[model samples]
Target: MAAKRILIIDDEADVREIAKVSLEITKNWDVATAASGEEGVTLASTYHPDAILLDVMMPKVDGLATLVKLNENINTCKIPVILLTATIRLATQPAYVEAGAKAVLIKPFDPALLGGQIESVLGW
Candidate 1:
């Protein structure tokens, strides 16, 4: 099977690096990173990644707004998006789910388990 391609959108450079390295080394996935939601949206259309790991909080174009934009575009609407958030409030999970997030991963995550979590969420 072809390696899964994943796009990660996060403002923090460290977070993006961690996720990119973790996914690549652990799963041998093709990974890409975008510093903001707008960039992510643009890359999503062109790259056609199998999935997206989106940060919930950002300075401009937060995750929810980005998700909306992605859903609005026919080219990206079907791609699964998993939210990476520092917030663990139960109330927010459904909101993200309603906004079309495939899953949510809390911040300070274990890099080793990240791939497994994503696979479980995507049912891969």
Candidate 2:
């Protein structure tokens, strides 16, 4: 099997670094990082990652808006998106589901389990 390509969008530099290193080292996945939702959307359309790990809160465009923009683009509409939040219980949230997020993962996640969580949610 090929390495899974993942795009992580977050405003916090530390968060992005942590997730990027974690995913690359733990899962051997090709990971991309974007510091904002707009950048993430742009990257998604071109990079065409297998999945996107999007931050819920952002300055201009949030994850929900990014998801919508991604869905609107033909090149990126099919990629699965998973929302990341510092808060909890978004997995059961209607708005996130309605916004096209496949799942919601909490912050401070176990790096070792991140791949498993994504695989389980996406049926990878």
Candidate 3:
């Protein structure tokens, strides 16, 4: 079977690199990184990844807004998205899910277990 692909959308270069390394090396999955929401949309559209790890806060376009835009496009709507945020309040989880996030992950996460966590969320 072909390898599963994941798109990571985050402003922090280090976080994206860490995630890419973990997912690619440990999970043996194809990984793509985007620095902004617009770039994320473009990459995701082109890559058609199995899942997306999106940061909640960004300069040009925030994660929620970006997710809505992603869902607006039929080609990208079916892809699962997980929100990566430092501040995940009780009130926001439901809203994020309502906004189309499959899961919410706190920042400063364990890079070692990150792929496993994503697999658990994806029920893989």
Winner by TM-score:
1
Model 1, residue pairs in steric clash: none
lDDT score, candidate 1, position 83: 95
In the range 1-124, model 2's lDDT, one tens digit per residue, is 9999999999999989888898898889999999998899899988989999999888899888898998899999999999998876635478889889899898888888898898899998
What Cα-based lDDT does every candidate model obtain? 0.96, 0.90, 0.94
Candidate 2 wrongly placed segments (more than 4 Å): 89-92
What tens digits encode model 3's per-residue C-alpha lDDT throughout 29-120?
Answer: 99999999999998888899999999999998999999999999988999999999998899889889998899999998898899999999
Q: What is the TM-score of each candidate against the true structure?
A: 0.98, 0.93, 0.97
Clashing pairs in 3: none
- Write candidate 1's Cα lDDT for 57-77 as tens digits: 999799999999999999999
Number of the candidate with higher TM-score, 1 or 2: 1
Q: Compute the lDDT of residue 73 as modeled in candidate 3.
A: 91
lDDT score for residue 29 of model 3: 94
Mark the regions of model 3 whose C-alpha exceeds 4 Å error after superposition: none
